[model samples]
Target: MSLVKKSLAKTASVVPSSTETHAPTAAIDVAQANAPVTENEQKEYPFFVAAIESDLAQLKTFTDIADKASYKSEALKRNDYLGYIKRYRLSGQNHHNTVLAWVFIWLVDLKRWDDVLELLPLMVEQKQPLPTVFNTKHWPAFVIDQLYDDANYYLSQSEQAGLFTISFVLHRLITTVKNQDWTGLEVVGGKLYAMAAKVDASLHNYGFAAAFAEQALAINEGAGVKGLLKDLQKLLKQSEPEQAVDAD
Candidate 1:
């Protein structure tokens, strides 16, 4: 027992009492670790908002359709439109600048069809929904909230969107025709011609329908489509002047 006690005391003495000791490992600072990289007050449009706004101000002065078209032409020649979209990140619909972006889409579809086409593939690549440049579900509803209380603004937008819609569809018709898509051409051509007969036997813009029919006939000159041509001609020969329909 004495020997065991001596051994224990020696062991205890051998453990240096003055050895340096370390504090326990500190716990991670969870709040600091999970903090956002960007501060809340930092500007979202820091890079090119000023430049974009300046360009947009110029567009705002282009209330005239012809003048606005000229601006679009000039911008496309210099590739200013594409740079604007990339710089402002205008491809998205959820940004703070959605209103501005959509307005840009409106003008582009009217006067910048090729640029609008240029954007379609990019939207597909980025997995973003196609912007309103191609498909607008309802024209007036689109502008009603934005152009509210100004009846003339609403009417002008509706009428202009209508004109643009027909022209845009015609553009598509020409594309499908060139691609030898008879079913597509037929489908598109049928809709326009049928729409002509809808309003009290009035051919609402059958001239474009006739244009599509002409293209379709040139592609497939079978007697099957001859009847359709005859029907369109009979309607065309009627005494009623063509009336334009607001693009729905």
Candidate 2:
């Protein structure tokens, strides 16, 4: 087998192993052993395994071509890389998962903002939960596997539901920070920001919107988000009683 194949087999084993070691801290984490690893758990293993295997192969091909081209930028100029970029860029539904984020990052590094914007959702969705990522030091299988998968549904429900989702996710984020597991927070907070933005926008809850937007900005201020600070200001002013009356 090739180096990539061997490396992945190694990663697969190590991920499960870490989960085994950290099974005691949280009850949710304890149950992670049965949380359906995949290969998330890959939406919980045969699927995870297959998806990961396929992704690794594609990644290897991308890198090999990138290296030979030298400019790195030069490779992206080619049809093969360009095609991959276009194929992965999800249009409206904008979501990101871990696997695609890695590729999307490279595109960003190349300063392809327009391309990145189109692909942003996928890159972002890649962080969402796309292909499960387990056992990486940054994201323990336990954390990824245990995060409430129903968070989106919660956000889609009433404000109360959205609040609960935020609390639930925020608590976990704090716990990881306490434990100094910065890596565990990967894409985890995005769930919070996305949920918060939806809830606030629906209610015109400027206070919460500003807060969540701040948090997201601290992490990253992509074009869609970089405006949160100023946007919130404008939104509040626009909603003021005087401004509303002025429309008449």
What digit string (tens of lDDT, one per residue) describes model 2 on residues 1-248? 42223444665632222123332455654454344333312322232334434544555665455453344454333223443223223122233434344444455444353454455333333445433353443322223233333444555565576555444454444333333323445355544454455456555677766676666555444414556657887877777888669887
Q: What TM-score fits each model?
A: 0.31, 0.31
Model 1: weakest 10-residue lDDT segment is 139-148
lDDT of 1 by residue, 1-248 (tens): 22222333454521112222662233433433344433311233322344344455778887787887676555433333343353233223234443234434554445344444444334334444324454533222222222222323323455555444444533542343343333534443333333322211222555555555555455445413455556667777673443333232
TM match of model 1 to true structure: 0.31
